[model samples]
Target: MPAPFTADTVTVHSPATSANLGPGYDSFGLALSRYDRVRARVRSAGLNVRVSGAGADELALDEAHLVVRAMRAAFDRIGAQPPGLELDCHNDIPHGRGMGSSAAAIVSGIELARSLSDDGRARLSDAEALALATELEGHPDNVAACLLGGLSISWLADGRGAAARAATAEQLAATGIRPVLFIPAEQSATRAARALLPEQVPHADAAFNAGRAGLLVLALTSRPDLLLTATEDRLHQGYRAAAMPASAALITALRSRGMAAVISGAGSSVLALALADQAGAAAELTPVGWECARLEVSSGARTSGA
Candidate 1:
């Protein structure tokens, strides 16, 4: 039999994530400082949900809510489910625009479920939790980084999600790397952006991305000078450029100014890997009506009141 719920309330703070990072498509991801906070409580008979901040107006308040769905999935995996749930979501990450908002929600839900169960941590190991989150999110890059923090490299192993942290928080802080984001008012859907790619890319382009992806690991961890070259990608960005013309043009312009820049994820947001001296210049390039923010690399999701 499964262990009963021991905690009446649980809170999870999940970080936003940026995937692809230019050349490591579907493999590399970085956690950003922005976060979404969810507080879940057990109830005797009814479900209640409240939302504030980003997506508050449009997001569903019932069982159809993404966080609720993820919590239910985690409860199923743990062999138990609470009678009812009350959720309070305070969101900071924007919806869509390739910022890993979905991944954050999924991660938060799984963590909440685990925290509420007396033996949930024992039943669901970290690897199992990650796999469950990946299953719910349909990809590992964003969820892996949101769960593990810093720089993460994820892949599929035996049809399950597997990930490892490439750069430690200390290493990243020492490099003084700042991620400057330029977010457009318009959002781009990941499905639409993915459909723009061809079934097969040229061998030469594949080789190019492989080389750059490897260099990206080194550049992000140690050699900051190589970032411009390391961030180069020919596999997916060009193919999806038409879907986010403004983003593509902004990346081109940033690179021309000797800064390392690339499309954040699928598109419509640009990420520039800037140093302390370069962050200001990168922000200045943000076009009118676009939102710009400079953020630091963040730690993984945190939980309280478990």
Candidate 2:
């Protein structure tokens, strides 16, 4: 699909993300430099989707599209009559690669809905946006990182989920660690990867991951040296290894070399937290078919022409 530049467009640039950054599991997420662009304009009374880039051929072009669903979800939340929308999506985030491509779409749509409401109200508040996105996303980590930027830590208490952002780009700059992603051609569905986890784990293993999650936060914020031990996980990755053997093997190999490596989100993409000076070090270890990129932690989502 062709993307035409126009003065009437409201556009958003949302970053792709690596979630579950090591031991934090569903509670952790990190935004990467790569992004997906969404351009939206108010239409009369229908939906139109024009997609270019990853999954363009396979993704829906109408109401069933993830972006459209998100917009509807947002409109319902605000008690606003939904407006017609025309969406031009340029998706770069790899699908099913544990990179939060879906989260990007969800955030883009919610923002689009906010940008197009007829009431001419102030833009959706951050809290409203987070709540709407979380309702559609089923968790807060990835969507929070995509919506709020930087690194996000989410948890559930009293059957309600709450998320907070940390490790902003400025903080990461001070920490002296770089994010290196190893992306494989093969895709592993998040649902399938999640299914591999057992219903129960050893009490010791659960305690181990809890301790590591705390250390991982420290490593991400002020203590880069602790990253080697901090990224270790005893929860989901090992159990999901069979779903993406290549990713599992590559993570193991990277860690063996003293790099702090772990599955990016679920599987199929590996993130190695490398020292800033050694950012390029993980590239040499990439296997034959996988791709590697060094990414900075993004600040947050941005919208123009809103």
Candidate 3:
């Protein structure tokens, strides 16, 4: 097939993702409607990034940026010399809040590379994109969700384990899932949240997380009522409670009310998986100092131009 790029410019809209999804720590993810839009084109002889929205002033505008790094990685993988690039980033995903901003940026870059290169007369395939994005992000949860949309189940495995590091996404048949996000004013770094987890969890806790994670898949597919139980986590959240007390508190409060609430990705932002009909109910429970939004599951990444 001919490459998708026929002009100098390519634009990609990559969705922000919420990973972990409660008990499925580091393994499950869901792509939200929110996104970061990136536009790239051949320009000059150097890399330049222009940013607007979320991290405009704080994020770098040079080649060292995550987007540039990912684009370069994609080029290197395909044995193509990267071109002089101009990147425009209109970011809506919040930084350092476990909303997969980095993952979105990485996917954006990889898609940009695929759109720009045609050295082998081939465009990037979904598997190639996922593999490269996973390589750059070191995990597939968020990246897979950003690339494939809906819900993603990912794992890294040794030969003896379940499966080698791989990711896949699915669109659920059950459609009433309404995601209400409670984004706090303060941001929590993913690294800091991860540091709070112990090297290993208790065996029973692991079993509990495993069971709930399995149940979660079922609940998400058909039984909305089971979400409260399915979303229970005995793995990562409590260990990192101190890192984002407000998020922890909000989660507790919602769950106590029989709502399926969880810390989105890591912390600082909470997600209440409510039924579409219960959107107003979830909105009514939004706590102070947090921005709330009702979001749907995004179909997937969309690329256009050239």
TM-score of each: 0.98, 0.93, 0.91
The Cα local distance difference test for each model comes to 0.91, 0.83, 0.81
Write down the worst ten-residue block by lDDT for model 1: 1-10
Q: In candidate 1, which residue ranges exceed 4 Å CA deviation?
A: 1-3
What tens digits encode model 3's per-residue C-alpha lDDT throughout 4-121?
2334688999998888889989888888899999998865467778999998889988978899999888877767655478899999998988899999999898888887776422
Show how many residue pairs clash in every candidate, following the order shown.
0, 0, 1
TM-score of 3: 0.91
Best by lDDT: 1
Q: Measured by TM-score, how close is model 2 to the native structure?
A: 0.93
Question: lDDT per residue, candidate 1, 99-200, as tens digits?
Answer: 899999999999998998878888888999999999988889999999999999999998899999999766887888899988888888999999999999
Residues 117-168 of candidate 2 have per-residue lDDT tens digits of 6442344577768777777888878888998788888766554556788768
What does the lDDT come to for candidate 1?
A: 0.91
Question: Which residue pairs collide in model 3, if any?
Answer: 6-306
Off by over 4 Å in 2: 1-8, 118-123, 157-160
